[model samples]
Target: MDTQQLEKETLEKIDQIVKNNPVVIFMKGTPQMPSCGFSARAAQALIDTGENFGFVNVLADPAVFEFLPKYQDWPTFPQIYIDGELVGGCDITLELAESGELKKMMAEANAKHAQQDA
Candidate 1:
């Protein structure tokens, strides 16, 4: 495939991942082994919520790492999405986690998605 086509396909795959999952994080690595401190903290924050979530390891996918910031207009790693919405990065996630809002938000997003799926 051509460069443009490859990028297009990657974007589509990202779109599907975001839309299909109730909670998703695009970080430098997986939740178990984050590549960066920011990614680790963000993933931990989500994990603290006790909700099941999906993740994309940017380090493993060059196209996603190159195109995600442009796609979401968020120029950073460890981007978190709740119900297909950009919920910001590490600091924001940590703040939400500390405030007890992250868990509530995760539950609500999960419930909403579950209803949609049902």
Candidate 2:
């Protein structure tokens, strides 16, 4: 498939992901067993926030690896998205945690999702 088709497919999958799960994490692996150090750290940050989230293992899909970078325009793995928006990788998550912003964002996200569910 062409780049356009691949991009479209990747984004559509991502959209479905975020829509189905309130908090979606497109990281290296499952939250229980992250494939990389960055992914593990990102998961930890999310855990610290005390919110449950969904995770997609890009390592499990070759197409996802080939197409995800183009979708996010980010040359890295362990990408985290909140409410369907990219929130950078492990370093950004660590920074947010150190500043206590990660927890705050998680709380806000949880509240927003709770409102939607209600």
Candidate 3:
């Protein structure tokens, strides 16, 4: 496939990833024990907000590992999304946490997700 086709495919896969789970977390490891400091921080940010989230360890999925960067246009581990919208990476999450905005965002997202699930 050409670059454009590859990019499109990557985006479709990412969209499916988010749609498959209401509170999906694309991190370096499971929430219980994150493999990287950034992933740990992001995981904590979600927990700190009292949001129950699902995780995907890119370390475990070759296709996800290869395409995540193309999907997000960001070459980094521990990317986060809220209801399929790319919220940001670790630093942005941390900043939101420190500012007390993370909780509000997560709470709202959680409630929205809960409604959808009902």
Candidate 4:
């Protein structure tokens, strides 16, 4: 496919992933083996929340890494989304985690998504 078409498809896939999952993290790697410190820390924060989350490993997909920032206006890896909304990167996630807000937010998001699914 052409460059534009490829980018369009990538963006659409990203949109679907973000919308379909209530809690999604677009990071450098998988939750078990993050590619960067930021990703590791961010993934840990989410894991601590005890809420199941979806992740996209940017390192595995060049098109997503190149075009996802435009999709959510987040210009970095380890971007967390709750209810399909950007929740910022590592620092923000850590802050929320420390404040005990991350768990709550994640739970609420999961619950809301579960309701939607049901």
Judging by TM-score against the true structure, name the best candidate.
4
Number of clashing pairs per prediction, in order: 0, 0, 0, 0
For model 3, the stretches where C-alpha displacement exceeds 4 angstroms are 1-11
With candidate 4 superimposed using the best TM-score fit, by how many Å does residue 37's alpha carbon deviate from the native? Answer: 0.2
Candidate 2 vs 3: which has more TM-score: 2
Whole-model Cα lDDT of every candidate shown, in order: 0.94, 0.81, 0.81, 0.93
Writing each residue's lDDT as its tens digit, candidate 1 over 13-87 gives 999999999999999989999999999999999998899899999999999999999778999999999989999
Per-residue C-alpha lDDT of model 4 across residues 39-79, encoded as one tens digit per residue = 99999999988899999999999999999988978888889
Instruction: Point out the higher-scoring one by lDDT: 1 or 4.
Output: 1
Instruction: Name the candidate, 1 or 3, with the larger TM-score value.
Output: 1
Model 4, global lDDT: 0.93
Clashing pairs for model 2 are none
Best by lDDT: 1
Give per-residue lDDT, candidate 2, residue 114: 85
Show where candidate 2 strays beyond 4 Å.
Answer: 1-6
